[model samples]
Target: MCRWTRQDRQRSHPLNIQRDEYARRRRQLMRMAGEDAVLLVAAAPERIRNADATWPYRQDSDMHYLCGFPEPDSVLALLPGRKHGEVVLFCRERDPEHERWHGESIGTERAVELHGMDDAFPIDDIDDILPGMIEGRGRVYCHFGSEPEFDARLLGWMRRLRQLRGGGVVPKEFVALGHLLHDLRLYKSRGELKLMHASANIAAEAHLAAMRMATVGRHEYEVEAELMRTMRSRGAVAAFPPIVAGGVNACTMHYQANRAPLRDGDLLLVDAGAELDCYASDISRTFPINGRYNREQRALYELVLEAQLAAIDEVRPGRAFDAAHQMAVRVIAEGLCALGLLAGTADDVIADGSYKRFYPVKTGHWLGLDVHDVGDYRVDGEPRMLEPGMVVTVEPGIYIPPNDTTVAERWRGIGIRIEDDVAVTRSGNDVLTANVPKDAGEIEAWLKRGMS
Candidate 1:
């Protein structure tokens, strides 16, 4: 077991996910894959932004989930019944020249020691070595089509194996890795939950800062800057590009160009989260730009908040994954109908799907290593049951397009969403991002304290 020590804490980031935990996950996955299979996981390719510039490298979530190795040009292999080694890693060799530009590469020997791999080799030698390991496997598991180059190489290895004289049995079947792997990822471990809570706390502070700085005449990006600064200062990064939409801009669900200026009486909707140690936290909050919501904004905002609360209540164990969405839709439909935004009763609005005009997206998604993390929402054509250790976001919103002209003008162009990270528990659920205020009155009071 890789135990965390005071020295380790001083030398590195506080979130110390033990090596044994990763090993346990690998063992669990291998057990599921069975002894006759060979599993291969490829690292994420670094992407280029423009000339000579590259976007920040993010490790493949699947690869990172298995081992905490943080380098590209790496491959993880699992041969369950292999006597020589069950876990293998092929990674970049140490190069002083490359180290001068980039950072040090954890060479093969260090990789074996640090990540507890049974064997390690240079990535450049994979083609020469890996095919021999794959020659006898009955089934091969990998993320098919994710990386064309990797897939092509894998296919080439298999073809060569088939042609070789007196070679051992080549893999007869190729399996999609996600179906098995993603299910494991859906359930969070203790370490993962800790990291997620930390991520949510960092994001909560950022959202609070955005609310405090959201005054009239401030540009959307300015508030976004505050969010970025807060997350970065806490040694975290944005889980996704921050969405700081103001007024009618909020009507657009995926609004990204946050350049609009804040105006008095218009609601500012900030949808953002922080990524800490690869675990992501997503939260969305809509507040008045001038520390006070107008009548229309207050009505929509309160309705969204009510819907979010109702949805969060359905996040307990045994509930279906979509239980929150159903509750949220019910509440939002009733509220909208009462507000005269829709002509029919709440039941009719839901049954006819008319409520989708305002509430387009789902109530939430599974939150973990990726913001919109892995795992199938359905199993056997039915909604999957919510289990303990499953983390989800309860985000309910209402977006009324500005030009609808279908109802009163006061209700148009007002967009409101209240979102929080919720973790299902044995008893009920825990709201990870509860540090931030969601109630309209609480938001006004929070802003007032900051202004004072």
Candidate 2:
């Protein structure tokens, strides 16, 4: 078995920003939580992949956003006005034996020194110690339902406080932390944008690599393998399961079976992204397996490209969050009608939602730490207006399943989606993944480079 060396760890470190950035995030959260509020956030639990083995450990996005501490069985507590400390961390204690077998850990003391937590404690003591911090606060801010065990413990503490209400003032209210915290996270800081840009860059290279690998007679997994190799070597992992769908498989969104062999004149659709420094980049590109799109494929590809460009152009500031989706829908509906795929006027087809048969998904979603990152799409019952510093995806597509009888025989089994990571700016939007070619001719030329 291969073992990881120090160099391997060093290469994977995307912590280019100063440690104080995490401190700044905590400060922001504390300000939002208010002096009378107590905030509780838990680190993600390690998930078991199989018998006696674990999947790769990834920290919770909310927890990692507040503090860059990467470890399991940890939690963060924020008491904004406390004299002893405003921020506290409960984390794993250092045990030499455990470190030898599992991995080295950042113990409590260093958690304070290195990570800027005001105080720290062993996770074992949290059960005994945390409730006391919650005792007199007016409100508790935390994400309930995210961790069921933590939710039960929180409720238990509340019940205990209720039972002993006569003894002293007890925290009386529980509020969801996501309301304020996620809003804060929705807007990216300059450093955060830089990290996201880096992630997009890596994902773009991986997409190009996968494109080069998708030759006729090759299994879909071969392209996926090329992607994984590029990602792992560069210290990134897939933000989500990569969709390496070939031919008919492309018609199914979220397709996972990468066992099909690519055939000449067939198209491959890859929806994959990379996660770097906890920030994610999502990109999807459709190209030909034989280095060229066939006549029918090219017609559908150009239509989808037109719709995508229109949708992407709608990603500027002040536009409604749904504007991109609406724009894409209109474009797709109009194109389908023009191609004789639909019989009515574009207006009628879109008005009645008949176009959903071909385009069933929204144009895109917010992009960040999670591939489908968190942010309120609607605010106060209205579609939220876009603002600068927000990043979102502009993906527009059409999928015609192989067995569908509604469309022409040649048009079936064609799925084309063009997605790019876009960042809203004061003037307009920036396409972070623009380096990867999306044009039909551009893609064909790039694939030809591999053959040469």
Candidate 3:
């Protein structure tokens, strides 16, 4: 078996995000917001993990997408064609005492020098100052309800500005910033793709490690620990809480309680990802607890893999957003009917949603910075067409819960999901998490040989 040390993990990944990348993103967003518009985006607020302690602060995805400033209690206001500057940042001020206890502050002075901001101000004066910036704008493109407290404050600013309309101009229009901003973010840049590729490779290694360590007697959390160690050792954090569901536990979507004991003949489904440099890669794999799968387990696993592969084929440019999901549903429904899990024809099962008994939700979702990343799958309530540069997950699953008496006893209590992160290209799709094997035969060989 191959042993991976933290030093090895450290050397495997390098960050590629440059300062200019964020600046370009800001310029792109400004183009979306016209000359007379002001786009207000707030930083993610601090939360109390416990008394006096705080949760690990992560910047808002939209805010971070435009400006790569990684501090808290900050806001970015982009005013195109403004006299002084286009990018104005409001952030915490420099306090020697506070810095001594907590950490360094990206004071207003350095915000302009280091982060390319046109002008900067202390967050202390936001209420008095931000409204002035908001005044005389034709359109206010802002995240209206992301931060409720900030939302109320913004409303107050708008109300106060409305009162002063005798001389001052309040924004005549309020447009949701996400509509335009998310669309910009939906397409990945070269830097973003590089980060996502690294994330996916790291996650693939973690999954292989988990598979190698898993045994009949080991607990689900024990396997989860292996995954965490592998990711953190590589300096990437999990995109989300891992779903290390074993046997019947796998039937529950979004299963978090990973304390179940691994059974000798049961399947262990692992759904996890690594987030490298704020870019996320999500992948899922299902394998037997022991080295190899049993007869019935292999049969069901192969069916899911078939559906997932067929779905991935739909992840190409000009295809509809739901094309992959529709493909997966058709394949899964047909496979189930052929296997006698469903009696009706594939078309009948799909039309009546009889396949929901085994397959519950759509195949997968968009994958990026946030796990369920920002992007509209629909425009004008119609399915949006998939385009080049969009990354999506192709996950098709079948869960036969233990209590459900619909299926045969052999088929019940078996759940399987195979997923991979695919980036849509002009010609086809690129699988970011391809290093991780979803095929039963390949997974068994890898597990037995250990990262060969």
Candidate 4:
């Protein structure tokens, strides 16, 4: 069962500088749109199993970025190029009857106060109120292909405006809001950094806990449960589904069944993270389930760990985004050649794309509010340069399938991945999740301590 501790409730770390930061982002987006107004909506309520059952609701990331409010059927409208032009939110009204079955609703009044909105109104009255807001506005800014329901509603509103063309009402243009917000979010604010750091710390601790709990005969799910418990105790949630693959299961990337029992000679690969204050931390670690790695497993693990460290060393401001990936690929290619897993020279294997037989996926990705954060790497359809305040994951792995005959029997089914959260800095990169024990010695020590 899920447990919520007293400390979770008592310790309140309300986000700081949230309002000002959000306002600045909205202003930038407004400037980019070159429009008089923009309209954005939060995620609508979703149906679950049946009409009687509904899924737990979470607000859209873009909406939360602007308003920091998590409620269903909410809207944010921004009017730009005008004095006193800012943000307004339309949300659910107060209803004591509905509150009885569900829970307390923030209501319109408190939403304006808490969310820093210029004005607030009941969401039910959107149709009546929106036309007035849209009137005389030349262009409307919103994300296309996001929400089908919202798309239908936007079309309906556009049709209504078209009907009023004879009545002296028209919209000259429709712009994609994604371009504006994506650009703004690419650079992390100080407030966002704090939350991301906290998330990294939490995820690091959870990984430590999983490492300590792992043992021969323990099911992978048991270790996953321990990690979940640790996260919950710290008032955090999983950034994604915890991947706890043991033995041959480790060869499968994105393996999350987590039901297999660990064996004496098997390796365990765990890819998990914690989400704190909506910011996410992604981390992965692989170790021996029996507290000591055999020679083959140790060699593979060290190579992968070395490749990860080499990649991380390349993370810095002004560097190409692909630098770390290239470094890791080179290291893995050389390692495979040394191990006789590849026949030809490292250069030949790498150039011919034969190295992908061992490492199929990219080394890592950007890590932030979402596990894979937004912001297209292309400016004008070109790779974006790395800059300060950007956070990313440096993970390098080598997976040897159980059925593969290229390597020795002992080396088969041994998969290893080492990941860490890195924040690009003015001088270099800071390892945000450094508190976790990652080195082979430190991991072994942690396991021993847990056994005692």
lDDT of candidate 1 over 213-300, digit per residue (tens): 8899889999999999999999889999999999999999889999998998899999999998778999999988888988888888
Report, for every candidate in turn, its global Cα lDDT versus the true structure. Answer: 0.91, 0.88, 0.87, 0.81
Ranking by TM-score: 1, 2, 4, 3
Candidate 4, 1-452: lDDT as tens digits: 96543323322357533667777877777777665665565555565767788765555777777767767878888877545546778888989999788766777887777767878889888776776667788888888887778888787776676666465365677778776786677678888888888888888889888988898888999999999999989978898999999989988999978999989988889999998766889989888888887888888888898898899988998887778989999998999899888888889998999888789888778877788988776567666788998888998899888998977887788888888999998899999989887788888788888888
| Candidate 4 lDDT score at position 171 | 66
Ranking by lDDT: 1, 2, 3, 4
Steric collisions counted per model? 0, 0, 0, 0
> Clashes in model 2: which pairs?
none
Among all candidates shown, the one with the greatest lDDT: 1
Q: Which ten-residue region of model 4 has the weakest summed lDDT?
A: 3-12
Residue pairs with colliding backbones in model 4 are none
Writing each residue's lDDT as its tens digit, candidate 2 over 1-452 gives 97775423643565544567877888888887789999999999999999989999899999888887778899899999999999999999999999899877789987888778999999998877887887789999999888898899887777666666476467878899999899988998888899899999999999999988889889988989899889888888888889999888988999998999999888999999999878999999999988888988998899999988888888899999899899889888988999999889999998888898888988889988888899999999999999999999999999997888988899998998899999999999999999899999999999999989
TM-score of each: 0.97, 0.96, 0.94, 0.94
Compared with the true structure, what per-residue lDDT tens digits does model 3 show for residues 4-90?
A: 533234324456566688888888888878898999999899899999999877778887788767788898999988888889999
Q: Model 1 clash tally?
A: 0
